[model samples]
Target: MGSVLAFFVLATVFFYNAGNWLVVSHLPQRADAIVVLMGGVPERIPEAVDLYKSGFAPRLIFPDDYEENPPEVLPDGSLLHNDAAKAMHLSSHFNIPDSVIVIVKGPALNTQVEAEIMAIYLADHPETDTIILVSSSYHMRRALIIFRNEFASKGLEITIISVPSRYTAFDPEKWWQTAGDRKTVFLEYIKIAYNLLWDRWF
Candidate 1:
Protein backbone atom coordinates (compact mmCIF):
# COMPACT_ATOMS: atom_id res chain seq x y z
CA MET A 1 0.00 0.00 0.00
CA GLY A 2 2.81 2.39 0.86
CA SER A 3 4.57 1.67 -2.46
CA VAL A 4 1.37 2.21 -4.40
CA LEU A 5 0.64 5.47 -2.66
CA ALA A 6 4.22 6.61 -3.20
CA PHE A 7 3.89 5.83 -6.88
CA PHE A 8 0.79 7.99 -7.16
CA VAL A 9 2.47 10.87 -5.43
CA LEU A 10 5.50 10.69 -7.69
CA ALA A 11 3.35 10.47 -10.83
CA THR A 12 1.40 13.53 -9.85
CA VAL A 13 4.59 15.47 -9.25
CA PHE A 14 5.97 14.64 -12.71
CA PHE A 15 2.74 15.64 -14.43
CA TYR A 16 2.59 18.91 -12.55
CA ASN A 17 6.21 19.77 -13.33
CA ALA A 18 6.00 18.96 -17.02
CA GLY A 19 2.42 19.99 -17.64
CA ASN A 20 0.90 23.46 -17.96
CA TRP A 21 3.24 24.91 -15.35
CA LEU A 22 6.01 24.92 -17.92
CA VAL A 23 3.81 26.40 -20.63
CA VAL A 24 2.03 29.05 -18.62
CA SER A 25 4.92 30.14 -16.43
CA HIS A 26 8.16 29.25 -18.14
CA LEU A 27 7.47 29.84 -21.86
CA PRO A 28 9.38 32.74 -23.29
CA GLN A 29 7.14 35.51 -24.61
CA ARG A 30 9.51 36.49 -27.47
CA ALA A 31 12.49 34.99 -29.17
CA ASP A 32 14.76 35.26 -32.19
CA ALA A 33 13.38 32.04 -33.66
CA ILE A 34 10.93 29.23 -33.00
CA VAL A 35 12.00 25.58 -32.92
CA VAL A 36 8.88 23.43 -32.91
CA LEU A 37 9.86 19.93 -31.86
CA MET A 38 8.06 17.57 -34.20
CA GLY A 39 5.96 14.51 -33.16
CA GLY A 40 3.35 16.17 -31.05
CA VAL A 41 -0.38 15.99 -31.79
CA PRO A 42 -1.18 17.42 -35.23
CA GLU A 43 -2.90 20.33 -33.51
CA ARG A 44 0.41 22.18 -32.98
CA ILE A 45 0.61 23.28 -36.62
CA PRO A 46 -1.80 26.18 -36.30
CA GLU A 47 0.01 27.39 -33.19
CA ALA A 48 3.33 27.36 -34.97
CA VAL A 49 1.85 28.94 -38.07
CA ASP A 50 0.11 31.55 -35.99
CA LEU A 51 3.39 32.44 -34.31
CA TYR A 52 4.90 32.91 -37.72
CA LYS A 53 1.92 34.86 -39.04
CA SER A 54 1.99 37.13 -36.01
CA GLY A 55 5.71 37.81 -36.56
CA PHE A 56 6.84 36.24 -33.30
CA ALA A 57 9.60 34.76 -35.34
CA PRO A 58 10.18 35.37 -39.01
CA ARG A 59 11.33 31.74 -39.33
CA LEU A 60 10.16 28.38 -37.93
CA ILE A 61 12.41 25.36 -37.58
CA PHE A 62 10.87 21.87 -37.50
CA PRO A 63 13.45 19.20 -36.67
CA ASP A 64 12.57 15.86 -38.17
CA ASP A 65 14.12 12.66 -39.59
CA TYR A 66 11.51 12.12 -42.24
CA GLU A 67 12.17 9.39 -44.77
CA GLU A 68 11.57 9.69 -48.50
CA ASN A 69 7.97 8.48 -48.10
CA PRO A 70 5.05 10.00 -46.27
CA PRO A 71 3.48 8.13 -43.34
CA GLU A 72 0.47 7.01 -45.41
CA VAL A 73 -1.42 7.29 -48.68
CA LEU A 74 -4.40 9.41 -49.63
CA PRO A 75 -7.94 8.01 -49.80
CA ASP A 76 -7.70 7.93 -53.60
CA GLY A 77 -4.42 5.98 -53.24
CA SER A 78 -2.17 8.88 -54.16
CA LEU A 79 0.73 9.38 -51.78
CA LEU A 80 0.03 11.73 -48.94
CA HIS A 81 3.18 13.24 -47.65
CA ASN A 82 4.18 13.32 -43.99
CA ASP A 83 1.36 15.22 -42.33
CA ALA A 84 3.65 17.59 -40.42
CA ALA A 85 5.79 18.21 -43.46
CA LYS A 86 2.76 18.65 -45.67
CA ALA A 87 1.13 20.94 -43.16
CA MET A 88 4.11 23.24 -43.41
CA HIS A 89 3.96 22.74 -47.14
CA LEU A 90 0.33 23.83 -47.11
CA SER A 91 1.16 26.98 -45.14
CA SER A 92 1.48 28.87 -48.39
CA HIS A 93 -2.14 27.92 -48.94
CA PHE A 94 -2.86 29.96 -45.83
CA ASN A 95 -0.81 32.91 -47.15
CA ILE A 96 2.04 32.53 -44.65
CA PRO A 97 4.38 32.24 -47.65
CA ASP A 98 6.96 29.51 -48.38
CA SER A 99 9.84 31.49 -46.97
CA VAL A 100 8.81 31.24 -43.34
CA ILE A 101 9.28 27.54 -42.40
CA VAL A 102 12.50 25.56 -42.49
CA ILE A 103 12.24 21.80 -42.11
CA VAL A 104 15.40 20.23 -40.66
CA LYS A 105 15.53 16.42 -40.80
CA GLY A 106 18.06 15.41 -38.22
CA PRO A 107 17.86 11.75 -37.17
CA ALA A 108 15.49 9.23 -35.62
CA LEU A 109 15.41 9.69 -31.87
CA ASN A 110 13.92 11.74 -29.07
CA THR A 111 13.53 15.50 -28.84
CA GLN A 112 16.92 15.74 -27.16
CA VAL A 113 18.47 14.19 -30.24
CA GLU A 114 16.58 16.62 -32.49
CA ALA A 115 17.35 19.59 -30.25
CA GLU A 116 21.03 18.69 -30.42
CA ILE A 117 20.79 19.07 -34.15
CA MET A 118 18.94 22.37 -33.73
CA ALA A 119 21.63 23.54 -31.35
CA ILE A 120 24.29 22.68 -33.89
CA TYR A 121 22.36 24.45 -36.62
CA LEU A 122 22.21 27.59 -34.50
CA ALA A 123 25.90 27.30 -33.83
CA ASP A 124 26.75 27.21 -37.51
CA HIS A 125 24.39 30.04 -38.42
CA PRO A 126 25.83 32.42 -35.78
CA GLU A 127 23.34 35.07 -36.87
CA THR A 128 20.46 33.48 -35.01
CA ASP A 129 19.83 33.74 -31.30
CA THR A 130 16.88 32.81 -29.10
CA ILE A 131 14.52 30.00 -30.05
CA ILE A 132 11.16 28.83 -28.78
CA LEU A 133 11.61 25.15 -27.97
CA VAL A 134 8.17 23.94 -28.80
CA SER A 135 6.83 20.51 -27.80
CA SER A 136 3.95 18.98 -25.87
CA SER A 137 3.72 20.42 -22.40
CA TYR A 138 4.39 16.99 -20.87
CA HIS A 139 7.69 16.81 -22.68
CA MET A 140 8.81 20.40 -22.13
CA ARG A 141 10.64 19.88 -18.86
CA ARG A 142 12.78 17.09 -20.29
CA ALA A 143 13.26 18.98 -23.56
CA LEU A 144 14.41 22.14 -21.86
CA ILE A 145 16.76 20.22 -19.58
CA ILE A 146 18.36 18.56 -22.59
CA PHE A 147 18.47 21.79 -24.63
CA ARG A 148 20.01 23.90 -21.89
CA ASN A 149 22.64 21.31 -21.00
CA GLU A 150 23.52 20.69 -24.63
CA PHE A 151 23.08 24.15 -26.16
CA ALA A 152 24.68 26.20 -23.44
CA SER A 153 27.89 24.16 -23.64
CA LYS A 154 28.07 25.23 -27.29
CA GLY A 155 28.12 28.93 -26.32
CA LEU A 156 24.73 29.73 -27.80
CA GLU A 157 22.27 31.98 -25.99
CA ILE A 158 18.93 30.44 -26.83
CA THR A 159 15.58 30.98 -25.14
CA ILE A 160 13.16 28.07 -24.99
CA ILE A 161 9.39 28.19 -24.57
CA SER A 162 6.73 25.53 -24.20
CA VAL A 163 4.13 26.14 -26.87
CA PRO A 164 1.50 23.69 -25.69
CA SER A 165 0.91 20.84 -28.09
CA ARG A 166 -2.22 21.67 -29.98
CA TYR A 167 -5.67 20.85 -28.63
CA THR A 168 -4.15 19.34 -25.50
CA ALA A 169 -3.87 20.60 -21.97
CA PHE A 170 -2.14 19.25 -18.88
CA ASP A 171 -4.10 16.81 -16.75
CA PRO A 172 -2.75 13.90 -14.70
CA GLU A 173 -6.04 12.16 -14.08
CA LYS A 174 -6.61 11.87 -17.79
CA TRP A 175 -3.50 9.74 -18.24
CA TRP A 176 -4.88 6.49 -16.83
CA GLN A 177 -7.70 6.20 -19.35
CA THR A 178 -5.45 4.69 -22.04
CA ALA A 179 -2.67 2.14 -21.80
CA GLY A 180 -0.53 4.14 -24.20
CA ASP A 181 -0.95 7.29 -22.21
CA ARG A 182 -0.13 5.53 -18.96
CA LYS A 183 3.00 4.01 -20.47
CA THR A 184 4.18 7.33 -21.82
CA VAL A 185 3.77 8.98 -18.45
CA PHE A 186 5.66 6.09 -16.88
CA LEU A 187 8.56 6.29 -19.32
CA GLU A 188 8.69 10.05 -18.96
CA TYR A 189 8.85 9.67 -15.23
CA ILE A 190 11.81 7.35 -15.60
CA LYS A 191 13.52 9.76 -17.99
CA ILE A 192 12.97 12.59 -15.56
CA ALA A 193 14.53 10.56 -12.78
CA TYR A 194 17.49 9.67 -14.96
CA ASN A 195 18.01 13.27 -15.89
CA LEU A 196 17.86 14.36 -12.29
CA LEU A 197 20.30 11.69 -11.15
CA TRP A 198 22.71 12.33 -13.99
CA ASP A 199 22.61 16.06 -13.42
CA ARG A 200 23.58 15.63 -9.81
CA TRP A 201 26.46 13.20 -10.42
CA PHE A 202 27.79 14.19 -13.84
Candidate 2:
Protein backbone atom coordinates (compact mmCIF):
# COMPACT_ATOMS: atom_id res chain seq x y z
CA MET A 1 0.00 0.00 0.00
CA GLY A 2 2.80 2.39 0.85
CA SER A 3 4.60 1.64 -2.41
CA VAL A 4 1.44 2.26 -4.45
CA LEU A 5 0.81 5.54 -2.62
CA ALA A 6 4.39 6.68 -3.23
CA PHE A 7 4.13 5.86 -6.91
CA PHE A 8 0.92 7.85 -7.25
CA VAL A 9 2.44 10.82 -5.45
CA LEU A 10 5.55 10.81 -7.61
CA ALA A 11 3.49 10.51 -10.77
CA THR A 12 1.31 13.42 -9.76
CA VAL A 13 4.34 15.64 -9.32
CA PHE A 14 5.84 14.54 -12.64
CA PHE A 15 2.65 15.14 -14.58
CA TYR A 16 2.23 18.61 -13.15
CA ASN A 17 5.78 19.63 -13.89
CA ALA A 18 5.78 18.02 -17.32
CA GLY A 19 2.83 20.13 -18.46
CA ASN A 20 4.49 23.28 -17.15
CA TRP A 21 7.79 22.52 -18.83
CA LEU A 22 6.26 21.73 -22.21
CA VAL A 23 5.14 25.31 -22.80
CA VAL A 24 7.96 27.82 -22.23
CA SER A 25 6.65 31.16 -23.56
CA HIS A 26 9.45 33.70 -23.28
CA LEU A 27 8.62 36.00 -26.17
CA PRO A 28 10.47 39.26 -26.72
CA GLN A 29 8.72 42.41 -27.88
CA ARG A 30 10.89 42.61 -30.96
CA ALA A 31 13.65 40.63 -32.62
CA ASP A 32 15.93 41.07 -35.59
CA ALA A 33 14.74 37.78 -37.06
CA ILE A 34 12.06 35.15 -36.50
CA VAL A 35 13.43 31.61 -36.82
CA VAL A 36 10.99 28.76 -37.36
CA LEU A 37 12.58 25.36 -36.70
CA MET A 38 11.39 22.61 -38.98
CA GLY A 39 10.41 19.03 -37.95
CA GLY A 40 7.13 19.32 -36.12
CA VAL A 41 3.67 19.78 -37.63
CA PRO A 42 2.66 22.53 -40.07
CA GLU A 43 1.39 24.59 -37.15
CA ARG A 44 4.84 26.01 -36.51
CA ILE A 45 5.05 27.82 -39.85
CA PRO A 46 1.69 29.51 -39.46
CA GLU A 47 2.62 30.64 -35.96
CA ALA A 48 5.88 32.09 -37.19
CA VAL A 49 4.06 33.84 -39.99
CA ASP A 50 1.64 35.34 -37.51
CA LEU A 51 4.55 36.61 -35.46
CA TYR A 52 6.14 38.07 -38.56
CA LYS A 53 2.90 39.74 -39.60
CA SER A 54 2.60 41.21 -36.13
CA GLY A 55 5.91 43.02 -36.76
CA PHE A 56 7.95 41.00 -34.27
CA ALA A 57 10.75 40.67 -36.78
CA PRO A 58 11.65 42.08 -40.15
CA ARG A 59 13.15 38.83 -41.43
CA LEU A 60 12.07 35.18 -41.09
CA ILE A 61 14.52 32.29 -41.30
CA PHE A 62 13.74 28.63 -41.80
CA PRO A 63 16.58 26.12 -41.39
CA ASP A 64 15.65 22.79 -42.87
CA ASP A 65 17.28 19.69 -44.46
CA TYR A 66 15.01 19.67 -47.51
CA GLU A 67 17.91 20.93 -49.61
CA GLU A 68 19.66 17.61 -49.06
CA ASN A 69 16.67 15.62 -50.30
CA PRO A 70 15.02 15.37 -53.69
CA PRO A 71 12.61 18.09 -54.65
CA GLU A 72 8.94 17.30 -54.30
CA VAL A 73 7.01 17.82 -57.54
CA LEU A 74 3.85 19.83 -57.18
CA PRO A 75 0.63 19.52 -59.17
CA ASP A 76 1.51 22.71 -61.06
CA GLY A 77 4.84 21.24 -62.29
CA SER A 78 6.84 23.45 -59.94
CA LEU A 79 9.49 21.52 -58.01
CA LEU A 80 9.96 22.34 -54.35
CA HIS A 81 11.14 20.64 -51.20
CA ASN A 82 8.80 20.19 -48.25
CA ASP A 83 10.39 23.18 -46.50
CA ALA A 84 10.05 25.41 -49.55
CA ALA A 85 6.49 24.28 -50.11
CA LYS A 86 5.55 25.33 -46.62
CA ALA A 87 7.38 28.62 -47.00
CA MET A 88 5.58 29.28 -50.26
CA HIS A 89 2.25 28.50 -48.70
CA LEU A 90 2.96 30.97 -45.91
CA SER A 91 4.10 33.58 -48.39
CA SER A 92 0.91 33.34 -50.42
CA HIS A 93 -1.46 32.80 -47.52
CA PHE A 94 -0.10 35.69 -45.48
CA ASN A 95 0.70 38.00 -48.38
CA ILE A 96 4.34 38.09 -47.26
CA PRO A 97 6.80 39.04 -49.95
CA ASP A 98 9.42 36.56 -51.13
CA SER A 99 12.31 38.88 -50.32
CA VAL A 100 11.47 38.93 -46.59
CA ILE A 101 11.65 35.12 -46.36
CA VAL A 102 15.15 33.67 -46.11
CA ILE A 103 15.62 29.93 -46.40
CA VAL A 104 18.97 28.67 -45.03
CA LYS A 105 19.48 25.51 -47.01
CA GLY A 106 21.69 22.75 -45.57
CA PRO A 107 21.83 19.21 -44.20
CA ALA A 108 20.16 19.96 -40.89
CA LEU A 109 18.70 16.65 -39.77
CA ASN A 110 18.06 17.56 -36.15
CA THR A 111 17.86 20.42 -33.70
CA GLN A 112 21.62 20.45 -33.14
CA VAL A 113 22.38 20.63 -36.85
CA GLU A 114 19.74 23.31 -37.33
CA ALA A 115 21.33 25.36 -34.56
CA GLU A 116 24.75 24.98 -36.19
CA ILE A 117 23.37 26.18 -39.50
CA MET A 118 21.68 29.11 -37.76
CA ALA A 119 24.95 29.95 -36.06
CA ILE A 120 26.64 30.18 -39.44
CA TYR A 121 23.87 32.45 -40.75
CA LEU A 122 24.16 34.66 -37.69
CA ALA A 123 27.86 34.90 -38.33
CA ASP A 124 27.18 36.24 -41.80
CA HIS A 125 24.35 38.59 -40.80
CA PRO A 126 26.10 40.54 -38.06
CA GLU A 127 23.22 43.00 -37.78
CA THR A 128 20.84 40.31 -36.49
CA ASP A 129 21.54 40.34 -32.77
CA THR A 130 18.20 39.04 -31.45
CA ILE A 131 16.14 36.11 -32.82
CA ILE A 132 12.76 34.66 -31.90
CA LEU A 133 12.56 30.87 -32.16
CA VAL A 134 9.17 29.32 -32.87
CA SER A 135 8.41 25.62 -32.51
CA SER A 136 5.85 23.22 -31.02
CA SER A 137 4.94 23.80 -27.43
CA TYR A 138 6.29 20.44 -26.33
CA HIS A 139 9.52 21.00 -28.25
CA MET A 140 10.20 24.54 -27.03
CA ARG A 141 12.02 23.58 -23.83
CA ARG A 142 14.53 21.29 -25.50
CA ALA A 143 14.93 23.65 -28.44
CA LEU A 144 15.60 26.59 -26.15
CA ILE A 145 18.19 24.66 -24.15
CA ILE A 146 20.02 23.51 -27.27
CA PHE A 147 19.95 26.97 -28.83
CA ARG A 148 21.14 28.64 -25.64
CA ASN A 149 24.02 26.21 -25.30
CA GLU A 150 24.91 26.47 -28.99
CA PHE A 151 24.84 30.29 -28.96
CA ALA A 152 26.47 30.79 -25.58
CA SER A 153 29.76 31.77 -27.20
CA LYS A 154 28.29 33.64 -30.15
CA GLY A 155 26.76 36.57 -28.27
CA LEU A 156 23.36 36.08 -29.93
CA GLU A 157 20.10 36.49 -28.07
CA ILE A 158 17.43 33.77 -28.47
CA THR A 159 13.85 34.08 -27.28
CA ILE A 160 11.51 31.09 -27.50
CA ILE A 161 7.83 31.35 -28.47
CA SER A 162 5.89 28.09 -28.41
CA VAL A 163 2.93 27.30 -30.66
CA PRO A 164 0.44 24.61 -29.78
CA SER A 165 0.72 21.70 -32.22
CA ARG A 166 -2.33 20.36 -33.97
CA TYR A 167 -0.66 17.03 -34.78
CA THR A 168 1.04 16.26 -31.46
CA ALA A 169 -1.16 14.69 -28.78
CA PHE A 170 0.16 16.90 -26.04
CA ASP A 171 -2.72 18.18 -23.89
CA PRO A 172 -1.23 20.27 -21.15
CA GLU A 173 -4.39 20.07 -19.05
CA LYS A 174 -4.71 16.28 -19.20
CA TRP A 175 -1.43 15.00 -20.52
CA TRP A 176 -1.51 11.74 -18.60
CA GLN A 177 -4.94 10.65 -19.78
CA THR A 178 -3.88 9.66 -23.31
CA ALA A 179 -1.23 7.13 -24.25
CA GLY A 180 0.25 9.33 -26.98
CA ASP A 181 0.69 12.24 -24.64
CA ARG A 182 2.21 9.99 -22.01
CA LYS A 183 4.69 8.53 -24.46
CA THR A 184 5.60 11.92 -25.93
CA VAL A 185 6.09 13.50 -22.52
CA PHE A 186 8.15 10.53 -21.39
CA LEU A 187 10.37 10.66 -24.46
CA GLU A 188 10.79 14.41 -24.09
CA TYR A 189 11.97 13.99 -20.52
CA ILE A 190 14.50 11.40 -21.64
CA LYS A 191 15.76 13.65 -24.44
CA ILE A 192 16.00 16.58 -22.05
CA ALA A 193 18.04 14.52 -19.62
CA TYR A 194 20.32 13.25 -22.38
CA ASN A 195 20.87 16.75 -23.77
CA LEU A 196 21.63 18.16 -20.34
CA LEU A 197 24.21 15.45 -19.66
CA TRP A 198 25.73 15.69 -23.11
CA ASP A 199 26.05 19.46 -22.88
CA ARG A 200 27.64 19.15 -19.45
CA TRP A 201 30.19 16.44 -20.24
CA PHE A 202 30.96 17.11 -23.91
- TM-score to true structure, per model: 0.74, 0.83
Off by over 4 Å in 1: 1-28, 68-70, 75-84, 90-94, 169-181, 196-202
List where candidate 2 sits over 4 angstroms from the true fold.
1-11, 67-71, 154-169
lDDT (Cα, 0-100) at 160 in candidate 2: 42
Q: Write the per-residue lDDT of candidate 2 for residues 1-202, one digit (tens) a residue.
A: 9999999999989768886677677745688888888876367777777788888889888886655256767688877666645666656677878788888877687888888889888878878877888878788888888888887757765544444433444687787788988888888889889989998898
**Candidate No. with top TM-score:** 2
RMSD of 2: 3.0
- Local accuracy by lDDT, each model: 0.67, 0.75
Residue 8, candidate 2: how far off, in angstroms? Answer: 6.3
Q: What is candidate 2's local distance difference test score?
A: 0.75
Instruction: Write down the lDDT that model 1 would get.
Output: 0.67
